[model samples]
Target: MRIEPAFLFDLDGTLVDSVYQHVLAWKTALDAESIELSVWRIHRKIGMSGGLFTNQLLRETEVEIDPERIERLRRAHAEAYQRYASGIRPLPGARKLLAWFTEAAIPWAIATGGRMETAAVNLAALDVELTKIPVITRDHVRYAKPDPDLFLAAAERLDAPIEGAVVIGDSI
Candidate 1:
């Protein structure tokens, strides 16, 4: 017997055209915190967990890090991202592909490193109904990408084994 593979997707840059928005949002947050960092540098950390991204950036910039500042940055990014949400849209083929999967009765889920506060914007662009779809966000898991928690949880949501799933994303 062969098992049908399940598809696990990333929401931000994969399904929605929100990667640059995320970079700019981070830039906004960093600027608000008086942290001077290049936009390209922030882009490099887009798909990573926010905590990891913040810690790495602070270490690289030799800046003092504190929980209070991290919270502030998170809030600022969420607010800034909301400002750019109006510009977000589904990728050219993202909606079509999802439709095809639905028509074909394929099991799929979205697993994003973003927490719900920011992910809601991208998900809205994709027209994803969270109640009908399995969406594993950073808010639902202890760790994010590179830790496999998001993908693992997504696979579980689909009742599919991790070995029988494929991850689709636009980042590392």
Candidate 2:
């Protein structure tokens, strides 16, 4: 089947196999705070921004974690994540799919909830070309996924119509 002319993809589980790293980071961060949350539960919140995910997870556990405290833990999680940065790898067929788009002259972009700095670091580890593809990350939008802000921003920046653009993600 012919692919869509414009492709908008998620960065984490879609392009790179960094979900485990995210889980590890969250686990380490929560552990530091003496809060024992399961990695499986944290894995379920992987796609959202650090602050949002932390809030959601805390609420699920019925824990009264201050927003400021959550932010601190998020920072620590980011630091812990950097240690496993080298383990990041592109998902099977991701590079091939990207190359196919390039060769077919189909425009593509990334719309991820991750902060731009973190997204850049992960993309660099995966050897993706930031300059060649448009990236609409958390820094580019006030709201994240399920809100359509990030994807809309990416389509806008890519000059691709939303109706004709395909949003590809591993999960809803």
Candidate 3:
């Protein structure tokens, strides 16, 4: 018998409406460093790892950030994100879509660019059952989207083939 296709869902923009919330959080964090970035620019780096995201923004804007500042910025972002995470919610039909996949016996998991702390908050906000769900977050992989590492990890966790797996996310 042929194996079924395993689905990898992105937690931020795709399933939940936390994209802008993330922007605000990052902005707040960067503000602490006195680094100002346009929301559009921040949004563009949302799907990348924290270090890569910071480096990209700095490169694009021609700014300078030391290693200590980078570490501080990461911590600040996580704290700020949690502070503003209460307002997060699921996207239209996100719950229904998850339910449909569950009821249909589809294999799925969350592969997100979010940190584990924020992932837990978003998952609780959405009330999505994750007892058996495998979630691969930024902490789990060396790279983020467009790299296929996250999806590949999820597929491995699901014991499914990667060739036929479909990734679902709202980011460009």
Candidate 4:
């Protein structure tokens, strides 16, 4: 019997229309640090880990951020995100796609740069249960995409082969 392919999805842009919310969250976080940045810049680095994202943002803009300050900013962002959680929702065809995978017994999972808790909150907001799907977040992977570590890690966790898996992401 031929093995079925695994559908690997990215959380922010691919499965849901939460990019704007994320931008807002980051903006809110940075604002607490008195740093202002463009949503486009934040959007472009959506798939990197929070620390890396912050570091990259600082580096690209030649801004300096204290370590403790960055942590505080992250916390502030989380709070802001929780406040607007209800507005987050899955994109068109996302639910249909997941259902299709379920009905077909095709293995599917999310490989996202988001923290486990944050991912959980967003998935819950979207009415998705992670227990039904394989998920590999920043906590589970040593490296994040566009390095393929998260995707490869998801495939491993699902007992699925990498060559038989296809990654569906909006951007690198």
**Which candidate has the top score in lDDT?**
1
lDDT of each: 0.91, 0.84, 0.85, 0.81
The TM-scores of all predictions, comma-separated, are: 0.97, 0.91, 0.92, 0.89
Error of 1 at 55 (Å): 0.9
Output the better candidate (1/2) by lDDT.
1
Looking at model 4, residue 84 earns an lDDT score of 70
Query: In model 1, which regions exceed 4 Å deviation?
Result: none
lDDT of 1: 0.91
lDDT of 2 by residue, 3-58 (tens): 35688999999999999988998899889987889889999888887768988888
**lDDT (Cα, tens digit) per residue for candidate 3, span 29-105:** 88888888888889877867677888778778677768987888889988999998878999889988988888998
Ten residues in sequence with the least summed lDDT for candidate 3: 124-133
Across 99-123, the per-residue lDDT of candidate 1 in tens digits comes to 8898899999999999999998888
Q: Once model 1 is optimally superposed onto the true structure by TM-score, how far is the C-alpha of residue 139 displaced, in angstroms?
A: 0.3
Q: Write candidate 4's Cα lDDT for 1-172 as tens digits.
A: 6767998988887888777777788888887777889889988887677878888898887877679876886678778777777788888888888888889888888888887767877677556676777888888877776578899998998899998999998884
Q: The CA-based lDDT of model 2 is what?
A: 0.84
Give the per-residue Cα lDDT of candidate 2 at 152.
89
Better of 2 and 3 by TM-score: 3
* C-alpha lDDT (0 to 100) for residue 129 of candidate 1: 84
Question: What's the count of clashing pairs in each model shown?
Answer: 0, 0, 0, 0
